[model samples]
Target chain A: MTGYLNIILRLTIWFLLTADLSWANIVIGVGVTILLPRGVTNVGLLKDWLRTLGEVAVAIPQAYKEAFEIMLYPHREETVVLERVKPRRTPSLIFLDIFLITFTPKTIVQRYHSRGWYEVHYIQRRETP
Target chain B: MINILSYTCIILGLVFWYWGTWPLLGRRSVLYKLHGLSVADTLGSMAIVVGLLLRIPHEWPLLVLALISLSIWNTVLGYVLAYCVTDDGTHDVGQEVGHGG
Candidate 1:
């Protein structure tokens, strides 16, 4: 009885969170079928369900943390700009570059010139851990 | 004349988007993406601005002000993020000085 109730509750929460019924329904349907109503008590499914909740809510904290970090960081008053990087031959990589640059706090994208290079200005270099 | 300019600007903006998303952006290229965004975010926005301006050229002041506000916002956002990296250094100073074994 408890296992049945868990599935129903999980289904409800999942539905509530995802407004896209068709897609969500399909996924939940397949997932439940694979796991089965009997295996509903399995810790894996329960763990995943809990994690999904966190992912939804954790975005708020993540944003706050990023913002806080940004504020507390010491940025030089001077602007360090990178000149346009002309990628020879293969030029279909601008979006990746833009997202990567914007995603990194240390780097700032200044401008992309007609010459096919993006100008980057950074106060400090950051290392990936 | 105004319509032509609007279409032209929009097309140019789309071109920027295409370039930014395609050639300018890709994996293994952080600088490219940053540069692409600068173009994609600006020129793509310019497309909308031109369209609006063409529709109501008299409202150019509003567009100008909007541009200014957006520029300020972007600048602040960039600076704020940079500040985060800088603050990390301050935290590390004590650790390095206290225990350098």
Candidate 2:
């Protein structure tokens, strides 16, 4: 019940976003949503994903603000440092981390280092673990 | 009023588009160049689509698809490009990354 509701809600949002209320597109979206793999029926994962997305949304303005600051202070010099980070996660999670980090302009994955460590280049290296 | 907001979004999106491209001219490494290009392109393009969405609310379906595709496609392409450019082989991959590079 919840899963179907989730599907309907998501498809509705998709419809609104697309602004294409055509019956064919709606049907296709519904079919695709229905055919998606149902590995884990945990609602908590959806919540977590939404929360993370919100955090990312908040980070964008901050990124733009930093970009503006960089433009204003050309001599400030952003230090691009390389760091080895071994994320204690599964392969899928590690891929997600890489995707997220690379998607953001502040940090990017250069390559995989030795012993499961990812060598990442960051504009400003944060000190928090 | 809505038109004003839409224009603002479009102009801001253009600024981001230009800003992203500006770094490409710098004598930076390939990673840095790809970073600027992909990030700016994704955000700027999405912003433009959103602005268009506001301007023409009836065309939301296609615009929304564009926005969704922008996020997924841009991220995946960036990962693929980075992976291809990274020439250090971990195990035995038959010289994949190096060959791609």
Candidate 3:
């Protein structure tokens, strides 16, 4: 029941965002919602997903803040640092991490190293000499 | 009042777009350039869409879709590009880990 409700809510939001009331759009939206791949489903633990979502929400605002800071203050040059992250669980979580971080202009995923580390490019303000 | 905010957002978005581009011309590494370009581009595009959303409230549905696509599709494209460009043919982690499945 909850899953169905979730699907309905997502479809409604999709329709509202698209602002299309046409039957074709509605049918397509419903089909896409229902046909979402099973691997893309929640990663087994609701709590972990919620925690990750909260982290992403927080990161978003911070990213915006960083974007403005970088643009407004060009004197402070930004440097890209490669950081390694190892997620014990599924690789999907790593993708989520990459997606959330990349959403902001502050950090992005550069590469996934075979050594179980993600090469993350972090934009940092360089310290004055 | 709303108009003022919308214009401000659009201008800010442009600033971000420029910010992203500036790094590209600099001496940064390719990964850094990619990072700067993608992040700034995505944020700026989203901000522009938001400004449009405010200006044309009637067309919000389309604007929101644009916003969603900008975020999702853009990120995915960036990931693919980064993966392809940075892949040294030595690392098989992506194939081994299997993303999006």
Tell me the tens digit of each residue's lDDT in model 1 across B24-96.
Answer: 4345234324434544554355556667778787666557555544433544454344334334223222121
Better of 1 and 3 by lDDT: 3
Error of 1 at A47 (Å): 64
DockQ, candidate 1, vs. native dimer? 0.03
Candidate 1 overall lDDT versus native: 0.46
Residue B83 error for model 3, in Å?
2.5
Q: Residue by residue across B2-98, what tens digits does model 3's lDDT show? A: 9999999899888878878887888755656766676567888888889989999988777777777677777877777767766554432222222
- Candidate fnat values, all: 0.01, 0.30, 0.38
Candidate 2 ranges beyond 4 A from true positions: A1-51, A75-92, A112-116, A124-129, B89-101
Span of 10 residues, lowest total lDDT, candidate 2 chain B: B92-101
Model 3 chain B: weakest 10-residue lDDT segment is B92-101
Model 1 chain A worst lDDT window (10 residues):
A87-96
Residue-level lDDT of model 1, residues A1-129, one tens digit each, is 234334654565444445346976869764874465464332324444444445435533353343334335533232434345534312223433443444333446544445565444443224212
Candidate 3 clash pair list: A17-B61
TM-score of model 3 relative to the true fold?
0.71
lDDT of 2 by residue, A22-126 (tens): 899878888877877654443334554454556557765665665555445442122333444443443434555566666676555666555666655444322
Model 2: lDDT to the true structure: 0.61
Off by over 4 Å in 3: A1-32, A35-42, A72-88, A113-116, A127-129, B87-101
